[model samples]
Target chain A: MMTLAHTKYIVLAALIFCLTPIFSQAEGLIADQKFKADNEIFVTFSGAVDRAVAENIANYTVFEEPDPDIQLELESATLSEDSTRVSLRFKEPLNTAMTHVVSIRGLAGIDKTTFTVSKSYLGYLFGILISALLINNFVFTKYLGLCVFFGTSKKKETAKGMGVVFTLVMVVSALMSWFFYNFILIPYDLNFLQIVVFIGLVSLTVQAVDTVLRKVNPILFNSFGVFLVLVIANCVIIAVPLILANNNYNVFETFMLALGAGGGFLLALYLMSSVSERMQLAKIPPTFKGLPIAFIVAGQFAMAFLGFSGLQIF
Target chain B: MANDKSSMQLITRGILSENPIFKLALSMCPAVGISTTVMNGIMLGIAVLFVQVFSSVTISLFKNLIHPRIRIPTYTLTIATWVTVIDLVLAAYMPEAYAKMGIFVKLIVAFAIITMRLEMFACKESVNDSFWDGLGMGLGFMVGMVVIGFVRELLGSGMILGYDVLGFKPLLFFILPSAGFFVVGLMMAFFNWIEVYYKRSKGLK
Candidate 1:
């Protein structure tokens, strides 16, 4: 039982077990950092570090990037159980919009890092809304749904009606598709069929809207009925669901995207219709009279819309 | 001989007389959205070509089996299937191009051009004729995309296929989304003018 080979094996096993902790905690660099809250930051080191140096409040400084002279006071520095992460709490909340920096002195391998506090939920939603509506307006910027955009935009009345119907269809279909994608398709591993599924959903949504509108209010249906069917083929309606799915957006975010896109389409249609209604009078060239001229005018609108790029809503 | 001549005419009609982008004004979205570079235009062009031809032939062969009441949905199903095939092939073979194209590839199902051709020509024609028609229309679309890409790249970036020929950008505006509309509109007007002149000369003859 106490042979020399067996003793050698036991000694090797014991040595390996004893060396794992030291090997695991060999590196001393900061591994990761998170801007957890306005008044708190969590910095994780690659390995176990010196606790005395990490917990010292005097060694840490936090300040906005623009002004480095006025440093925020650190209330406390606490080390985690593993001694690899340190939480730095400040006396005051950092500004959300400003770029912030955190520096640690007397730490050998920790480098300074910059971060910004996460946007609030409402702020994030507002950003998506304004982004879709103005910044990345589907009609002018992305060149989506131009078929209906140009078709119904000849007259303001028709444009407004079509816009309303299109918006209603877009929001409903987008939400329905999002539900199907997240709940049914993803669980079943059927993402490849999203195109077929989304198109089918859009068609069904349009048909349902058509029937319900006719029964609920015949007069309103008569005015809006023609554009309801066309909503099935509109790329904007399809694009919204695909985008939401691609980005893994939740229900409210999907709603906001759909609403913003629909609103942007409506605004573009109304504006184009207003100008085209007047454009019927001022055209001089024969070849460039109808659609060609309309395109050039739309190009100008696109140019103007480009100015909305990088606009901060929140 | 007559069938051959008609086939030739069918192919040529889509390119010159009834071009999808310029003449029919269908599928304007992709023409502007993806034609920023020559390579992008060609890739989408080839993808659409395959989808168009395959869908056309399938719908033509199965036109009788599909019910008239629900033909639109059936046609959409066929197109979506072909598009899915292309989408997968591209994703597997060319990840970089697929990344650039993004959702537009999936949105091919909503492309008015494919469905319009299926409804207008494929359903009514023989399988052979439908193939020719699809090939012609697809080629016409490809040609249109290449030309737009050429102009945009040449003027916008002063380069062609990543080659810096001009050494300096010309307008720099042609690459913008607005310039896509402008170029397309101007080209449409130019074609209109040429058509008018051709008609006037023929009347005199």
Candidate 2:
């Protein structure tokens, strides 16, 4: 046998070599914590429901209460069986203590089921995007941003111009909101001041844009004259920040939401313009000249979008 | 020359004769927005009322003081300052309502109602005349919002002031932006229809 000192040295070396993997494992733990902090809890229906039924359930916020801190990621329903199996995934980790009941209201063959949460960040992100774009759309569901929509939709040329302007404005506003919310508002514990801050920013941005446009290109400025001014207080500017805060999206996901909202705004404006142009040639009744006919057309369009509510592409 | 109306008559015209969204079709932005619920409509109406009355009074009072070249900017700044104050107050004490009202509160600065009233009436009238014009126009706007809100909340959500009223199932479509368009359109048509019926009955050729 070797001397005791020699054996001790060998034992120490062995311990170091064995403990290397454990020390390296600390990095993984950090990643897990980061993931847990960022990840949202989403639940996907696994079986026994059709895709349409599941989608309707997702859009139904009637029974589901609103939670400012918790973001609900309504995923598209996937059907595995003969229209029997349905599943949903949450955007964040589900609270094991709280049970989520998916109520299948008025579906003949569908059964009401409860879903368990699984830890998947990818699933949650996808579900959040779907929910944002379709199920609980800011523009469509809430009627939050109609001023821009109507103002832009009056003319096709103006609508395209407004679309470009809106996208640019949304991106800039979102970045400002993210920084303000994370750094200033949250740190100072002045969350109540969000509305004031966001509104001030929007007003300033609009005034700045107006000044620059008027100075640089009088022709373009005149073309956009009234609309440019009108867009300053447009709901999209203020609402996006509130939504980002409510949903608690990270930088990347926040960008996606901003993009989706901008796109949705453009979509509504474009659709309205096209419909209004068509109505111009059609003989609308005298009483429904300007706004009355527009409302009826909008109602029909809303009904059409309801079909997309059931799509679970994500 | 005989058709020229007095200041009071002109002010009344702004209320009913030249109603912005309904009759004159001037300011569609605020009318279409904030009409989703009674609370939102009322809050917006109050804000608009305050801004319109004050802006009209101030602009009328200082109409000659403002340089013609920069009058628009001066008026905008004045309106913007008041809007900022209102925004802060709502955010502080009425957080929930503020959240619900969203950007429309800020949009008051750009709302053609205040600016239009300033340009059309206040800039050309006495302070007293401008005040009445603002009040009448503001009330008209409030009426429009309330009417739209009543129809939308009643049909779309089947509830009023968060209380169940009609017992009819909520049509989710009505609460959406598309439904706003529909409701406003129908209301406008309905108003026109009534106007036509009354005109015909009174034989006002």
Candidate 3:
């Protein structure tokens, strides 16, 4: 017969596993609506915190509307048994359409971040897509891909082609490299070999693509030509794995980043090329005829994108 | 006697005629990023100078051993190894300088000029020729960095090498990327005009 203690441990482990997904879906201690119950205030955190952290009492603060002008009375502050939910019962139940803020500080998840949405993985990935694509665009804001940004941006058609190639190559290669990094290099304590490995991976991938395309899509490959070959040395191609590793982005986020970065790169490239094409007609000085003029234009673009810095989407 | 004269020409070429930044337009990425401060520019330039010289000489030494098909990858690996060494040594011995130029040092591996030199001059020439060429290119790169850095630093913060040049700073925009572009543009124009005027004076095309 199975021991009673053994059965209890198994049950607890299963419960934790099931609750983990739902709990981990929160960004932070989001003020959630208390299931149609009157006067009860519920604040749901994303993941299970150390119960000890919740017990600290000082880490939780509740403020009633008006932005720091008033403070709400907490009648009973109860941490859920699983430490995933915190109930901050107001002195009186919320009856009117009122606004309040629940400030949580210094609370870490059981083993991860409070912002990782573990259950609605798709939605989370979408946010990352938008974030990387627009908010922190690789070229405009982050300043990666400067070489290709200027190199192929002279003409609109070439820029578009380069953008498309960059997106496809970066997206596919980033996934493979990310998997290799997290699974192998990281475990073996050989992360110091990142530059060598990352460059090697990219070169190998572009080569594989070349051979595969030659075999399967000879016509398309021939049409595209040497563009794919040039990607091996593009700074951003190598920078992808480095950035992903530095941020320790989850798999979904990595995928989103690759897509978003590539998309942003394409968008920036297209925009830059059009702007420069117009600039060609402007009577620029002979000295500033080429790259110098382009740099100035790039600076203007950087300033325009800086406006996106104040966004609070994350 | 002819070899000495040719080596002299090689070193001078980078400083003026074949200047990497103003003329050839190589390694523009780091040129803009590090030129924000004069000290940063000089430090990064010196680091590049070292790597460019060593890598060029090494590539020249092993030119025969490297296969044509795999030369690009071989050159990259060589540059990358030297860069890593420079990066670590800087971090250990010159923490203060490394603190600022640390990221820039690693970035040297990807510098187009270093590899361009390897392909254009190093593999094609003897080790002795490669050394002078590397020095010229390295000096040219350093000069470009320092000049851009000087203008940016002096104008942006009213400082040069950490010494304040102006009473109160003006044209603060020079420090910004927008201003960086303009400075580089104006400088390019200035350099080009000088080159044109010099060539015309000498009655050469």
Q: What i-RMS does each candidate reach, in Å?
A: 0.8, 4.0, 2.1
Docking class of 1: medium
C-alpha RMSD for every candidate: 14.7, 13.6, 10.0
State the weakest 10-residue window (summed lDDT) of model 3 chain A. Answer: A110-119
- The best-first sequence of candidates by TM-score reads 1, 3, 2
Model 1 score (lDDT): 0.86
Q: Look at candidate 1 and tell me the lDDT of residue A118.
A: 38
Each model's DockQ? 0.58, 0.36, 0.44
Off by over 4 Å in 1: A1-116, B1-5, B202-205
Per-residue lDDT over B113-193 for candidate 1, one digit per residue giving the tens place of the 0 to 100 score = 899999988997889999999999998898899899999999999999889999999998898878888998899999989
Q: What are the per-residue Cα lDDT tens digits for candidate 2 across A38-68?
A: 2233232323334565456454321122343
Runs with alpha carbons beyond 4 Å of true place in candidate 2: A1-139, A144-148, A173-230, A238-254, A307-314, B1-11, B26-40, B68-70, B88-107, B152-178, B199-205
What is the TM-score of each candidate's chain B when compared with the real chain B?
0.93, 0.89, 0.91
lDDT of 1 by residue, A1-314 (tens): 56998999999898678655533422236676656666787788777877887899987777776688989899999999999888988888766545456667667544543333334455777888898999899999999987777788899999899889998998999999999999999999999998889888999999899999999999999999999977877899989988998888888789999999999999999999999999988954988988899889999999999999967755
Error of 3 at A122 (Å): 5.3
